[model samples]
Target chain A: MDFNFTPEEEAFRDEVRAFLDENLPENGTRDMEAVAEFQRRIREKRWVGFSWPKEIGGGGGSIMEQVILKEEMARRKAPALGACFMGLAWVAPALIEYGTEEQKQRFIPDILDGKYQWCTGYSEPGSGSDLASLQCRAVREGDEYIVNGQKIWTSIAMWSKWMILLVRTQTDVEAKHDGISCLLVEMESPGLTVRPIKNMAGGDMFAEVFFDDVRVPVENRLGEENQGWKVTVSALAHERSSISEVYGLTRSLERIKVLAKSCHRNGRPASEDPGFRSRFARADARIEAMRLNGMRFLTKQLRGEPLGSETSINKLHRAQLEIELGELALEIEGGLGVLVQGDSAVPDDGLWQRHALSWPEVVIGGGTPNIQKNIIAERVLGLPKD
Target chain B: MNFGFTEEQELLRAEVRKFLDQNCPLEEVRKLCETPEGFSRSLWERMAELGWVGLTISEEGGGVGLGWVDLVVVLEEVGRSLFPSPLLSTVLAAKAVDLNGTEAQKSRWLPGLADGSRIGAVAITGDEGRLDAAGIALEGRPDGDDFTLDGEKLLVMDAQNADILVVAFRTGSGEEDLSLAVVERSAKGLNIEPHRTMDLTRRMGRLHFDGVRVSADALLGSAGSAWAAIEHLQDCAAAAVCAEMVGAAEGALKLTTDFANQRVQFGQLIGRFQGVKHPLAEMFIDIESFKSLCYYAAWLLDECSPEAPLAVSRAKAYASESFARIGVDSVQLHGAVGYTWEYDIQLYLKRAKWARPAFGDAEHHYQRVAKLRGF
Candidate 1:
């Protein structure tokens, strides 16, 4: 019923604002040294792994506080807390949940310190939403497991120093999920190769990574020998938190407002156009709805309630919203929308074009809208499974 | 930072819902919708007896003195049952009095309106339904110590049953041009032509105010000030309407899902099909989103937050479209029989249609949001 943050939370918000005033990047730009320094400051503030357990080099922040930190950071458009997007977002949490003490000690600090990057290897050419049915083979030989697999859509594979990979160690189990195993593999391993794949945005942010009989030590095996499915499920859920999307959408909305004020059509600002304002307003409302829904989930999490399948609601919304925002931005640009970056006449330097093309990362990547819908339908609503 | 109903509010919701189930069920609603009057006097009196009419006004003003958020809980239940009454109009009119009426004016009208002894309605907008200050087209000319109103108020809800009409009209060529006047329904020059609409459960009428004259004391607040009252009522009403629409959407989805669970097609339950379930699932998402937006908007208004207007517009716009989609899909998912007159799906669909544009349609609110964002 109460929407006001507690005075302490308000004070914490003030603290975050002050920190941002001093340290947030100018125009959200980041250099290597700036990135390292930013990561160091946040890690010292214990915001890098804010919601993870303190025993594993985390801040062990209360869920609500973590939400506040995230909201404020996103509002300021601050760079991500650590350099390892996948590792800090999913891998570290997975390791804390399933990895041995040795694994935690060996990996948690570097991940939090921005010392190296980590990529994911769950989706194969044939494995996406049905990731548990992966056919990437890993045969146990003495103290090492010989792996052979090709993982596609592995974003950052070319730049990552390590990977949290999923493989089939025993294909004879009764269920597909039971036969899979998780492994921590080094990218510089003798038999591994990365071939960067240029996306529609004409960027090599994602790649096709091939593992040719790579030897991963037995100690690198995460969780049980054949229980990688559980780890992957948990990690993916973490990946779909929706908190980040709320912040991201808020920033996008602000940009859209600014563009509406500046962009002109028919000898007046597009913001003055009823049609243009209506679209931007609709987007604003949807984003606000998504943001409030995110807050509801945060409230639930604060109460120690497990956020079961409801997070899918935000994921589904985020999918549509990202596409809508990109289209709206381009629409605001009128004829210049078709022009790409480096074009003299283009607006926002083709940011909207790249954004429109980047829907795959959001809409189709973590779980397609269909997959999220199915989850909401069957799990959240308790309807008959389709 | 919690954005949910309190424990007492939860109990109040259950109680209201149970009362609606007993007194305002679908069968009763259907019976009323088919009738010319479109509402049962007995049920309306019973609701009033339950103090539902005074749920939001202050104690001295003969209300429960709760805020808009609490009122949303009641509205949602009313929407779920498709309750046939003049409750929303009465409540809004009563709120207008509380916000803009002088003390003497309040004392004269507040008790009657809150206790439901006398019903009230507000004609805030005229033709085209643009809900801003400039939309007040019911012209009022200064006549000595009185004002003579001329023109009609379109789509005035429950005008036939209303005992009082709080009319928003433009008075003269001055900064203080817009004003509100409280006129009795039995006034000599006023005419109420009962009308029909897509939503049969709710009565509508055109208020033809030909030379409707009232003393200057009839005016609520200062001259040229009804705009603030109009905006306040719009914000609160929009949030409540969202709640109502979300509830109706939830109800329709339930009807659709129940039918899907039993109805077999192609040798399988229709619920087993992705076609049937996916849209129902999407409706669920929209409903949840609408619920959040409604609550947030209500919260902002209750707190008198500066962002209240934008939040309310956002809720109204999203709820309008979401409820419409849910209403249409609810019928479509039910197959051939759902479109028939005997089926209840159209009840929700019709209400969705009317409620969407009542305060402001999706496009209207979107335009409002644009303006509010300083676009």
Candidate 2:
């Protein structure tokens, strides 16, 4: 029943808070430049992979400690380190779980040092949410495989140096889950091209990656051929676990509080209005609830309990709360909440307005709320599928 | 750092649930609602006999000296049964008297309250039933060996059955010049008007203290600093109410899922349809989210953190809105049968409707939270 941190954990949190206070930048800039600086600083401090094993050049912390670090960093409003993708979340875990000794030795240090960034190349144009139906082709020739296909929403493909990709190795298997293979494709390989896609957020955070007869050695394959479904599932599980829309919403709440205090409404502060106060309170409650849900998940992870379908529960709640917060921010600002980031005379960094405008992408990214609902129904509730 | 309940607490929860299932089922609640008292004295005695009445009170005063977590466990069970008793009022009164009352006051009242020989209710709301203590218009003046009380208190729960009434009055004109006085329910010029409420499971009454005379020793705490005690009482009550909402929400979700599995439509169980299935899933998610906050608030209360007030308000406001919505949606998903008086869905819905606006509506608590967060 205790929620307070132990004295030791509290001391550790204080240390981490102090470190973030001393290191994190405080100036405002465009997200791109901020992300670039964030990445560079992360590399300089060698703090890129907090959850990876020490043998892989990480901090060798437990999952709870990692959660604490994330919570503390977020509480301080520190920018996220750029390139938080397969390199840190997926490849690192997969390597620890299934990588050959040589593969771990080759990739772990480079990843931890930020020398190699990675993107997932799992979904093709036809795949989308029906991920097992991917049409990418790969054929074995001698000791190499030739890959040809296109991956949509290959996040940060232009910035990544490697990709953990899923491609079809066989087509006649009875089960669609089989007949797939996973490979680590080097970005420097010939016949590979990346083109950035402009998202609704007005950022080139995602790209389309095309592979045209690119050659990858047999040694580059992870796990086994026809086992790519399992690998992809593992990768997606990592992505879902890393989902902290709640953390982002917490930041939004803080920003909205500041906006309400400083922004004017009818010759008084916006916070003076009962309507704005009510909305702010609702947002605050949602944030607190989301934080506690995260703590429950973290506690379960620490106890080594199987998370399984409960991740869907977290995803659904977080996404809904985030959208609600966005809507509330707009309500708090009235017309000003709709102002764009670059709009002159806009207040409080326009973070809430930007969030309100860009929230649909969050709902669409990772997985849609409808899809999460289906997951909860089928997996968590054990209901019959449609 | 541990979030899981202790083995003892889990066992306590199981025992409480079992006791409530056997002693305070929905039929009993309906019967009590039909009665003029609006509560079951036998059930209250049984609960007290089981030592559930004085959970959070000090051991020297005949309580187990447990914390907020224990009270929440009991409250959740009470909510599951929609139990009609004086548990909420008595617990809150015990807390206020323990925290702020003088030794003489505690010695005079705690034993009787703990042993079920006496019942207590807090009267802090004014004529409009506003939550703000400053809104109270009750006036008290010291007259020799006694204080003359004259004001009307609205929406006092279980007042007809209470032996002691903790009345909040303005000793001076300022907002902070409020005081809590313990007045005997049989005091001269004390008038009680029983009223029917939307949720008949809990009793409500309006009390008018017309020049009621109380001894000088009846003042529970300092004359002008009862605001702190009243605030603490509000936080405790809010936390308990949130816990109750969590229980009701969980029950509604479970009942809806069971109905979804059993009820057939279009040649199959309607649970297979996305429309019904999605909302049910969302309700389950919302219930779980509410549980997290409720538990965190309970834990914060046990820790006695300065953040408890804000956390409790947040939990109460969120649970109030979420549970009410879920209750209504549960009935909608259950089809026409859910709306019938015989069906259990209405029971839950009624409890949720009453609970939402009891301590403070979602909007009221939300405003409290905004103030706490410096908005």
Report the C-alpha lDDT of model 2 over A1-386, residue by residue, as the tens digit.
65677787788788778777666676455666655766676655555676555556666655656666777766666766435556766777787777889999998777665665798897778888788888889999999999988999888889888899999999998988889998999888999999999977778888998889999999999888888777644432222244245666767677778777777679888889898898888877876776677777766666666676776777666677667877766676776776777888666667766676676666777788888898888777766687
Worst 10 residues of 2 chain B by lDDT: B125-134
DockQ of 1: 0.72
What DockQ results do all the predictions give, each relative to the true complex? 0.72, 0.62
Assess candidate 1 and give its lDDT: 0.84
lDDT of 1 at B54: 83
Compute each candidate's TM-score over C-alphas. Answer: 0.95, 0.91
TM-score of chain B alone in model 1 = 0.97
lDDT of each: 0.84, 0.79
- The prediction achieving the highest DockQ against the true structure is 1
User: Model 2 residue A52 lDDT?
Assistant: 57
For model 1, residues B1-375, the per-residue Cα lDDT tens digits are 886678889998999999989877898888887777788878778777888888887787888889888889989999998988889889888888888877888888999888788998878775777786767788888888788888898888889889988888887654358887788988988999988787888888999888989788988887676677777877777887788887788888888888888898799888888888799889998898878888988888988899999888888899998898888888888878988989999888898888889889998888888888776
